[model samples]
Target: MTTYNPNQDAHYQILREMLIEARQARGMFQKDVAERIEKKQSHISKYEGGERKLDWIEVLQLIEIFELSEVDFLMEFQRRVFEFNESTQTKVLQNVAKNAAKKARVRAEIVRLMRENSLSFSDLAEPPIRTRRHKSNR
Candidate 1:
């Protein structure tokens, strides 16, 4: 069973509403979107109703169908979905910075290891080693 978080639920609801508004603004009916995505109208309805979750690929398809600019969509998402309080916003920014720093450290370590081993980028792409069987004396 999944525990419910009000904040997460609210975010999803906001996104659902935004998707519905975007569709309406484009003068698109649920049936039109359904045909474009090869889904039933009910599917689109469920998605817009927040009864179904939209995966990244589905979201991308919807973006294309709506002919929305990626930047506009992201700006709307930031404005609507991430309407956090001041303290929360600060915390989120801090976390993002911390994560980026950690990623940089990890990348530096990987580079150091590659240099020490004299390994090229293609060396990392090579296939895994296979074990050979040895004959045993009876």
Candidate 2:
């Protein structure tokens, strides 16, 4: 029995492994992928050699071209895809939270201005600033 060991090179090693395995399983030559994808056979060769990276769109095309239909097959491909999406979403959420803090500061400034002007809520069509006022005696 042999344990499976994938390449450790970070440059599309997984992509290359899956690409070649799927292609061979489908009886596809490198030329077939090139013809279907409108790319050169050398490009496909480089991609399968773990020397090239494919974008998401290109990966999808390759998936469809290879006719991958099994759950295990899909999971292998989608694992990296999900990680990519998750990291992208984290960045977007961080930016949104930063922008919201800035907006809150600006809103506080606006409310301070309304209080300095003694403006009512109706006068500005905005809520009046809440404050704890003290009573004075003569």
- Collision pairs in model 2: none
Q: Which candidate is the best by lDDT?
A: 1
Mark the regions of model 2 whose C-alpha exceeds 4 Å error after superposition: 1-11, 70-74, 77-138
lDDT of 2: 0.78
**Candidate 2 local lDDT, 62-88, one digit each (tens):** 888988755666687568656755776
Candidate 1 lDDT for residue 136: 96
lDDT of each: 0.86, 0.78
Which candidate number has the best TM-score? 1
- Cα-based TM-score, every candidate: 0.57, 0.46
Q: Residue 136 error for model 2, in Å?
A: 99
Give the Å shift of residue 47 in candidate 1: 0.8
